[model samples]
Target: MRDTNFLIENNAKAIWHPMAHPADMRARPPKVMMRGSGVHVSDIEGRTLLDAVAGLWNVNLGYSCDPIKRAISEQMDALPYYSGFRGTSTGPSIQLAYELAEWFEPEGMVRSFFTSGGSDSVETALRLARQYWKIKGQSDRTKFLALKRGYHGTHFGAASVNGNANFRRNYEPLLPGVFHIPAPWTYRNPFNETDPAKLAELCAAALADEIEFQGGDTIAAFIMEPVLGAGGVIVPHESFMKLVREICDKHGILMISDEVVTGFGRTGAWSGARLWGVKPDMMTIAKAITSGYFPLGATLIGEKMAEVFEADKSGLASIGHGYTYSGHPVGCAAGIAALAETRRLRLNENAAARGSELRQALLALQSRHPIVGDVRGQGLMAALELVEDQTTKKPLDKAKMADVAAATYEADVMIRVSGNNIILSPPLIVSAADVEKIAVALDVGLLSAV
Candidate 1:
């Protein structure tokens, strides 16, 4: 076994963790996860816990996915890396693009632009949106609109478009001309609306108003997550996405779906766009593309946008933006294998079944624990919003939420805590028993918090 103490000591001194205070890591050392298999991960101390967060909501196929591992190994031995830039590309990358084109065909996506990860994918999509507008002779369409509490990753462009203040506050002076409208969160809203359908209409109207206020001719796109994941798994009303799509279409605004979390069956559909029967002009996809086995992402272009770019007589259609590892062969190989496994296992159906069980379990927990202010999610992605008072909906203290997360970890389950929200997103392949196990662990943690 590795020297746990030595590893922890060095890690504390050497590494600066993301989304965390540097001093906090030294004060309370982070868990040293040594290995993972299936939906369980083992720490350096040999304590195994059910990974409810699914490695940051990416590992849809879990850790012990041999097919993905084998594909990566075979690719590494053959041709590990190749630049898919300037007319140079590898066989695996080309094949993977073809596969993704087929996979996302239902969503009207006809072409794919590869990236290194989710942030890159978001950046690619945002840049492409502007480029598309410019190609169509709408050079003034440089502004972007998005929903509040939506996460688009941490890149400069993505962060600028991100709706969450926590992500944008520290990195001020973000890209100018990006506006945000209130999200369709029924639990709490400026309108004090309780009815989900009515709230969705109101939010849609808000989007329309924002577009008009900004001038539709000046706005390039309206970007959003179909179901907000990092923002506490805030699932919008059933019609919210469709309404947004309609508004975007009416305004001549490109709709960019940041499906980094909601893509690849996490939302019980092949893509979150399909979940609401709305086809976006562009979609940003990553995370579960290779089930977190390989870091890869893609910005999928719809037929409408592809046709414009492809038919452009001007040389402006040539995209100058691309990563050095744009289409790494190993990542593509892993993606190919992961996609096959995802289909073979029929994980989307399981996600729907297990997600239903999880939602029911969480709702029951809400009944039993007054601290659980709300339970919201779709498919396997879910969150329990804790509160100090049920009537007032007062949020629980952040420290107390941390304690609850610690208790859950001690109870042998790994969950993600964002503020007072305890997020759970197990692998799509999770069994019924796994759902129960997660519920039981959270029950213990909730009891401790109480």
Candidate 2:
């Protein structure tokens, strides 16, 4: 066995974790995950915990996925790496692209552009949106509109279009020409609208107003998440996406769905766009693409967009953007295996059933715990927003939320605490018993906070 103390000390000394302060790691120390199986993970200290966050909202199939592991091993041994750039590509990459095209055909996606991860996928979509407009002889259309509190990823282009200030404040002077409208979050909004349907209409009107104000001809695309993920699992009204789609179509603006978190059956559907019966011009996907076994993402192009690019006679459609590992053979192999298993197990159906049960349990928790102000999510992706006062809806302080997270960890449930929200996105394969355990552990943590 590895020396836990030595490993922790070395990690604190040498590593700077993402979304965390370096100094804080030395003081509090980070959990060193040693192994994982099913939906549970073992730390270096030999403690096992339910991974409710599913390794940062990925890992839909959970750990010990034999098919994915075997695919990766076989691919690495046969042909580990190959450049998909230019005219050169590998067999696995080509196969995966064909499979994805077929899989996303129901959502009107006919072409797939591979990437390294979610951020890359978002960046590619943003660039492609602008390029698509330029190719259509509307070069002035460069602005992007997105819903407030939506996350697109950390890349410069994606960060510019991100709706959350927390992700944007530090990185100022982001790409220019990006605007945001209020999200269709009924729990909190500028309209003071309690009714979800009304709020969605108001939000859609606001989007239309923004497009008109910016001049529809000047806007290239409007990007958003079907269900906002990193910004606290904010599930909008059922009609929200459809309305946005209509508005975008009317204005000739491309609609880009940032499905990084909602793709691959996380939202009880093959894709979030499919969940709402809305087709986007472009869709960014990652995380669950390879079941977190290998880093792989793709920006899917809609049939219309693909046709435009295909019909372009100019050399502009030749494309100048691509990554070295855009379609790593090993990653594609893993993705192929993961997709097959996802279909065989029918994980989307399981996610829908488990998600309903989980959401109901979370609502029950809100009724019992004064700290839980709101419970919101779709499918397995969910969040519990804590508040100091139920009447006024005052959010819980960061320190208190940290305490709650610590308590949850001690209770053997690994959840993610972002601000006052405790996010839970267990693997899609999570059983009903697993959901119960998560709820029980969260109850212990909430009670401790009280």
Q: Write the per-residue lDDT of candidate 2 for residues 1-450, one digit (tens) a residue.
A: 557677876867778888888899888878899999999999988999999999989999999899999999999999999886657989898899999989998888888999999999999998999899888999999999998899998999999989999899999999999999999888889999989999999999999999999999999999999999888899988999999999998988999998899988999998899999998989999999998999999999998999989999997787889998999999999999999999999999999999999999999999999989999989999999999998898999988898888888898999999888999999999999999999999988898778
Local distance difference test scores for all models: 0.92, 0.92
For 353-382, candidate 1 gives per-residue lDDT tens digits of: 999999999999999999999999899999
- Compute the lDDT of residue 15 as modeled in candidate 2: 81
Model 1 local distance difference test score: 0.92
Candidate 1 Cα deviation (angstroms), residue 374: 0.4
TM-score of 1: 0.99
TM-score (all chains, Cα) for each model: 0.99, 0.98
Poorest stretch of ten by lDDT in candidate 1:
1-10
Off by over 4 Å in 2: 1-3
